[model samples]
Target: MHLRFHALATACACLFIAPTLRAQTTSPTLVTATTNDTSAEQVVVTATRGAKAVEKIPGAVSIISRQDIEAQGLVSEDPSALLALQIPGYAPSRQKLSNFGEGLRGRNALLLLDGIPQTNPLRLGGREGYFADPMIVSRIEVVSGASAAQGLGATGGIINTITRTPTEEGTRHTVELKYGTQFHGDSASWKTGYMLEHKSSYDLIAYLGARNQDIGVDGAGRPLATESLHRAADVFVKLGKDFGPQRLQVMFNRYQADGFDDRVDVPGDRATGVPTTSQRGTLPYDAPRNEVRSASLEWTHNDLAQGTATVQLFKQDFSARYSGGVIATFQDAAIAPVGQLIDQSEIQADKWGLRASWVRPDLWTRGLELTLGADYLDDESQQRLTQTGRVWVPPMTYRSLAPFAQLEYEIGPLTLRGGLRNEHSRLKVDDYSTLAYYGSRAVQGGERSASKLVKNLGAVWRFGNTGWSTFAAYSEGFGSPDVGLILRAVNSNGRSVNNLVDLQPILIDNREVGVTWRGSRASLSASVYRSHSDLGSQLVVSNGIGSVQRVPITVRGFEVTGEWRPLPDWQFNGSYAITRGRTASTAGGSLDLDLGARSQGPDKLVLGALWRPAPGWQAHWTQSVYFSRDANEGKFSGRTSLEEHFKGYTVADVALSWDSPWGKLGAGIENLFDRRYITYYGQANYSGTAEDYYAGRGRTLTLSWRRTF
Candidate 1:
């Protein structure tokens, strides 16, 4: 059964207003500029590894400025929620500690920090989105389709976060304080941070921040579980030096979060419409937690081989501790019986990489340019049981060497772009034994090597003096399956690590076309895309054993984004996206079955308004509506809960800010209508289990104050 599009009725008719924060005293605009002149451009570096105007990128690109970050932070500080609200093709946020089912364009999106990879593809614990705090970030660049610009793990797209830098000369101190609560049932939370910046012969910035979150209540005034309750902290520092035509910079950041030890879960009944709740109790072990540390050193030269060159050395260390589970793999005869053992899993990953690039303008003619780059990465990862001291996922080492080249040529109002990347990778594993539940199979391990070549081509044409542009592009992305999961659950009698059928790399083919129109006060863009994969990864559970399945898949979608400023003091922006996906029912069958919720999400519509009514006063309002879907009914043979049937809901948020002589004060209200509803993830991916049937947060109030001196 091929999936088909369904019509959605408009859910809201009332108009609301709010405001955003800008660095200067002027009011914020949805686009780059607010005046009648429409030529102002926003520059992005993630699309092609070099700076280029958004209109010239020849692809779908989105830039979330600092102003937008600060404004949304007032409502919620979670980066995953921010991205989900702003990006059109991104899946809805789960509002939890993990991003396991948050897909971009029906696939995993690679995350980067200042051009350094943040995800360990082999393990993919889904905590990569929490590496950087929004307060320390200056901007984020998003490319919305499959791309090979920066090498591997971009099967869907790319998201690169750029950190803040000293914009003013001299010494400055900044402080921020925020508080949020539901005003019921121990639901109070607070965050505070301090930053210092000094500039002279050398530029330096340092920041420290901490947050404490308590229990939460749903819209119906029911107490929810404490799965997301935790204590979080961040430490960041950057130092830079300038030497005429050369510059060097070093940055380091450490982020840590730990769950509370006192709370225990009270399972809910999905079939009876009950939500999971939490209560204070003594536990056998600590709760789930994540600790991440990253550092990078970059050097840039203006004149290297008659072109600009940049080199970066980066490192990341990550560890995640999961809650205890009673499973077959956790059994240890020496420690306890199969059903009596309660053990936890902890993933450890350490990565280091070196990336270098050079851009040469006017290669052969005035309008021709070329970019060359190479990247090297070495990653070591493993998973082990904390209590039993048993290795669940044996130690594995992976290394990759990728070299790429990109080209751009301009003629009159038409621009052409192309790129190619070749990646050579090797995986080394040691002989290990599977868990006793899997027949205690002894697996032989050795080295496996493979290579992949990906390419992209695009063209952008601009109409003469009309502020209109059209683009078409074809791109390919490369990614590796979760190797750690497969090696640990192998039940085969005589299988070698090098010959496992599940270890093959995935290659995605993407094709897109779009048009954009920009005016002094309004801008609109629309795009349609299709992506295909001969061998894609999916998680399947059988007989209480979870494993990875490779199948053929296809995803198609269309998106529209628009922004308009009917008046100087008021701005309105909106976006809509519809995505559909299907996969082959059998290993090599035709694509006739609908994809699961983990790969496909419901249609989303988001609208926002901003107003600056007074000199020092700003107001903002935003609303999101998810449409109901029932395309996959009666498809899973009663194995999963609907899996594709989703009930729709509406959410609204409002914020107000004032600038006083002493500091800036702000307040926001989330879930303004207090609509009682289950989250999209919980409804669409239900497993008929009480532990996963969760509800969205209730009406919450947030207050904040900030100052700089």
Candidate 2:
């Protein structure tokens, strides 16, 4: 059902109950930073916008600590690649500049920086995973399910990255240096960074880092096609001051990655099974690049009306430029001929948001708590043809206001929680004309508005003194489709924004049940879940234009995770996940069609081990395996056709580290066997083009050193 302003007002009216509750001895817990300790009581703030332990949450949530990041960074610096091996139900990593086909739980996952959304949902650029360098990150929190906790674009789940903050009492200086190479061709990379942290009456942190990479060679001694010969850098700073029961913090970060113009793509032959490669040559246009600048200011008060209140104001400016190509839609009569024009697409967007929340524990009674919050976002975005300065996708403005209330009640061994969120979003577009290739149709524009009232209910029951618990959860998420693509795909006359069916937002419903057990030296967790959407959004690009196809979709999956510590110096962990999905055929009349690889990925398994051979010496190993899948049913057409067959592949990595008196020295080996195989994306997304097929990376060795003073 649709919710209006009056409903939101009514929801906020419950805040009146805040005045009756008395302030207790225990103040609201705040998870402002992450630590290396693996404590069971470690808190997470992404799930409910408040501090809550992972075991207490009623659904699957993963926390990748600093130690985990450091170990994984030895093999790869890409966050998407790290998540692909660590998180269950997450799709395989493309290992490219864009996270094009990486879906979580067979659906889109939202990326956040300290609770600020980094995804450009209006355009679907697929570049959110590379916003900042992993060196500056303290930890990552993943919530696996369709959740409306942080507002729109969370159909699959949420990945919130927490940045490093000042921890020590005095000023500290640190320097880091790392280098890696495949030892084949010119496949070498290096990174250097410096950081400073200070704390006393006020806290301050600053970091600067830069990374450069040469061409990457696959196991077959061939250079990969994308993200080669690139330079990336970032600058981050944070300042905070505490004033009795309140605190204020300000954070800023700027990141940029630019590709060199010294390489050219060598398309692969799908029929001949030849993978795409690259060689030294001059590019037709400027190389692809990404640039982003973000800042946020937050204020927290612990004694506000006998409750804890948090308010944040944030803004971000982002732009992404893609490779140039001679496509039909880019052929502007006023600029160049249809067959001679080479143009690139660049997306530019600006976002501003305000978030406010209040947590009142022990509201009226013990073990009873309430949380009230609201979020406001304003985003304006557009795409343009860089060469001709022509507006390829007209400017569009999106604004959303969501108000929510969450309640938790605990009784002995049972904990129950429920939340309701009302979202009101509006899109505004001005009248615009299509390109000549699309008949240059004249389309009228108007404002389109949508409202939804989503709900989440969950419960967790712990067995008496035993370390076992069972939980169940049902949640809903709300989000809009790619409005820019829909707006640009209108090739017919007499069309308005409000009348387009493709503009409707998707509402996903998810249900899950799980069990967990924690022993003195071992722990295990498992869950099964099902999620569906009556109307789903899928985009397909043809002739240099994207078209949105709306259909019904259903996805089901199960995940198992376990860890065992048999000895004080030895530990082992593993996880497995299986995901499958179906959608209504876009060919019309067909039903229950299998989703293609672009929409869903195959099963995944990961195993890891940690060993401490002696004092200050340790080693870590990880193995990732993807199972084979054959969805080659029906005809190959867009997202509905499951015409690709994916062959399974396995990769292994190892890291060794030693703590010396001067610093910590580390070494790692990726692809220890150097087994030659095609990547999951290359094999599963067979588009009959040489540029689409790619080989996985070859064996590589990395060395790193870090010191603090």
Candidate 3:
């Protein structure tokens, strides 16, 4: 029945798009731009630690304008709902925020706030996905692919969220109150903020926002899949003063999120006949809270004798807590198969960095633009292990240092971008102990260092009114090892887990090239990128150490996206990606059953439309489909291998809005077809299999209101 239904859905989608596919086969025009046109899009980025438009950088980048956020409709009022869908190569799903604590993918996109790192340095996992709020942002800038300068280990891309600034020379305050419903459910946001010029050469913008969601089950009356509360406020302060021909500036920001979701089992769990659903092992949500604080200083030389130079320094501190409920292995059904406990956690971390840049205005430097920078990381973490009626905590501390440089130059029709970075970090596990029967260990400390070089090179050609560009870039970065890999566990049989920390950090080298056209009516960008990994993380019966053995894998994929505005006020944005990741066995026995990383779902397709039929009134609609590939666990075949056959699913969304006396009013619907689907890379552990994997929310009706005063 699953196979038959999948085939039918595929056929239906093809039929629906058949008309658009066959009509007007004009010269293919692919478009993606981060900078606005004549009314240039408001562009400011911290992607490369720069205050310029992200599009000006020689890399693949995209933007999710604030206009698209509420128009596409948010689930549980989470921003990833609309943000992830706009970018190709990004595989997003509903289970994204629940299990992993955030909408994280194995490819690892690093998240930065304004300029501060949003990743929880103490924990390998980035808790930013679940904590992002729409009220505080002015725009979202993305630097696609490996960004070594952005973070310690980045495999996916860099997401730099820039906040609104103080009033330049206009009104200083605005307030918006919104209310909406999904399937008769309630969701709302109340925001009151001010932006204004301050003191001598200083500017500041401050806002307080509260967002709430009444989400529990699917519109179809299934168990509540996601539920949470979010109340956050942020203030951005910037002071700029002129010193001779140079400019000096200072800025600071703070953001925090606290919320919890109701218990929702993986759909696969129930499907596999394992009784996936249960009121047991659920979290009380009393343990969810996250805080981020950041501050930075910068100086710019506006009139360099020969060119321009910039220098910056910053410090970021982060902390988060998740009352992660009990995660059970199939056979542990006896005395503690279920419980409300946090098996994992990260205490906090402090990071500081510096960057310097120089550019020649007269080209006397031989097309040379130099940038050099360095950073330091101090992080601490601890994990809780539940044994025969007891909870034990193991502590760890980490430190890191890194420095990098890059030079870019252009001559005639060729522009080249290249850079290299060396990163190193040390992890120390402390005051650690386990059950004597399993493995008695007194306080023991362990340290590991990861170092790598990253570089980039790209070129573009110019012609009369049109320009075509193509470039290949390469970079190498390392991901910190999972903390649990070394921690010992006390099994149900009363045996202590053997030490497993022999594992190493996962490393990746990515290569990419693409073609683009910059024209008046349209802008298109298409790229093909691949990332190869060696000696990466593989799940073995995970202990506090390395898994049973080792293995290597490759993630090869393609993404195409474009934006077309053929007529005034009419726009279209669409993207599609076919991504496949595989791992071949190396040395080691089965770890974590090799059941797949739950993050590597199958193929994904997305389409978005923005139509302003009339001024102040807009209609937007988007649909995304996620595909899954089936496979047996390592124990089933005694090894890991790729199999053919696409798993199934499709989700649809629509929203319409109009200016109102109170504010902007709108309505929307999700999963209009009421179809069930699973994540491409089942994110819910074993719960992600066909039987227990998660599902899309059923038909939902939403109404919203927004006003700027």
TM-score, per-candidate, Cα-based: 0.94, 0.93, 0.79
Error of 1 at 576 (Å): 0.2
List per-prediction Cα lDDT, in the order shown: 0.80, 0.80, 0.53
Window of ten residues with lowest summed lDDT in model 3: 20-29
What's model 1's TM-score?
0.94
Q: Arrange candidates by TM-score, descending.
A: 1, 2, 3
Clashing pairs for model 2 are 268-690
lDDT of 1 at 348: 95
Question: For model 3, how does the per-residue alpha-carbon lDDT over 612-675 read when each residue is reduced to its tens digit?
Answer: 7887777776778765655433332233232223356677777788887776777776666765
How much is the lDDT of residue 69 in candidate 2?
Answer: 88
Task: Tell how far residue 210 is off in model 2, in angstroms.
Answer: 0.3
Q: For candidate 2, what is the TM-score?
A: 0.93
Q: Which regions of candidate 2 deviate over 4 angstroms? A: 1-37, 227-229, 541-545, 587-591, 638-642, 686-688
lDDT ranking, high to low: 2, 1, 3
Score candidate 3 by lDDT.
0.53
